[model samples]
Target: MGILDDAFLKSLWVFHLATGSCNNCDIEILDCLTPRHDIERFGMLLTGSIKHADVLLVTGAVNRQCIPRIKRLYEQMPQPRLVVAIGECALSRGVFIHSYNCPLPLDHVIPVDVYIPGCPPRPEAIIAGLVKLIDQRKAQTGQAKV
Candidate 1:
């Protein structure tokens, strides 16, 4: 992966995908966009297309049907992209680990760069995770912390 410059890191475009979640995590994800949280302050904006995304926020367990689709999406994402496994479901398939449909954890399908664990992680946690992601990029580029 190439180094991500400060400008790109400051205005990351994110795409959210739900494989087969219960919608709880998705709800919290949306909550981050609400006025109270104002995730935009961090320069993160949601994108409708994965091709334009700098980060992918994946929620839910990876069911058999979602594997191919996820692979396709991951392949389509632009270079220097990041994947974040949000919620317990995406991290380990949660309670669905034993389910026949959920055959793989998210990491097995796509390279996950960050993990936010919770039944439904709060907006604050999501923001913190993303901020850490930006900081990590800064460190990688040998850019001093602001």
Candidate 2:
């Protein structure tokens, strides 16, 4: 019944950020947008600017160089925003954990609402994770399904 109810889940605009990825996770994100997955069908859209986004889809590890930029982007987004860290790299730095350039995981840089783990999680997994996040939002706003 509130403004943050199911209405909020009707359309979720997302902004994608790649800190220091190998492009594998990026490609999978593209796959989610393609006709095959068609995430837009669920009212999920990839926006050009973080200011217009409801969710921040971050791919790749958080490196020293990208820390400030990523934090800035997170700050630019409007309130009631969600951050979904996609990929093993974003989750725990994966193979780059020992890399000198890798400074922290995505959450360490900014708060992460959900995490999709994989070298590069499949499109299906990405969609599922997003849905879960939406559901979590619904619950938090007292719009949970019966």
Candidate 3:
């Protein structure tokens, strides 16, 4: 098995970066960390440090002003880290796509893995994405099929 899979299974820390949002997606991400969602049960954790994170849970549209910071954060994370664009804004810039300050899609800046489709996906969906990441990790490790 490759080392990438081992690292993925051993730890799955999420780093949230709000480029430009209305708080709905942010709240959902927070809810996943709370007792109601019980993200820890699946070995998922929210992290402040990008260096230790395995997943990037990005919310909001990529604002023109925030582009550099977003690029910086993405570059700081380790090679194997995955990015989950978690909102309509993150996926296609939502209603803000043509806004003066909005930067369009998140893929314009960094590579994205899974996209949880919603203006703000539910906490359960966030947890499901985490599980999917774990499964992807396992598959990458050759412990399971893709």
By TM-score, the better pick of 1 and 3 is 1
Q: Whole-model Cα lDDT per candidate?
A: 0.90, 0.90, 0.84
Worst 10 residues of 1 by lDDT: 1-10
Question: TM-scores for all candidates?
Answer: 0.95, 0.95, 0.92
Of candidate 2, the 10-residue stretch with the lowest lDDT total is 1-10
lDDT assessment of candidate 2: 0.90
**Preferred candidate (TM-score higher): 2 or 3:** 2
Worst 10 residues of 3 by lDDT: 137-146
Query: What tens digits encode model 3's per-residue C-alpha lDDT throughout 24-46?
Result: 99999988888888787777788
The TM-score measured for candidate 3 stands at: 0.92
Candidate 1 stretches with Cα past 4 Å from truth are 1-4
Model 2: lDDT of residue 78 = 89
Report the lDDT tens digits of candidate 2 across residue range 1-146: 67655666899999999999999999999999999999999899999998889999999988999999998998888888899999999999999999999978888889999999998899999999999998888777777642
Off by over 4 Å in 3: none
Tens digit of per-residue lDDT, candidate 1, span 54-141: 9999999888898999999999998888999999999999999899999889998888999999999889999999988888888888
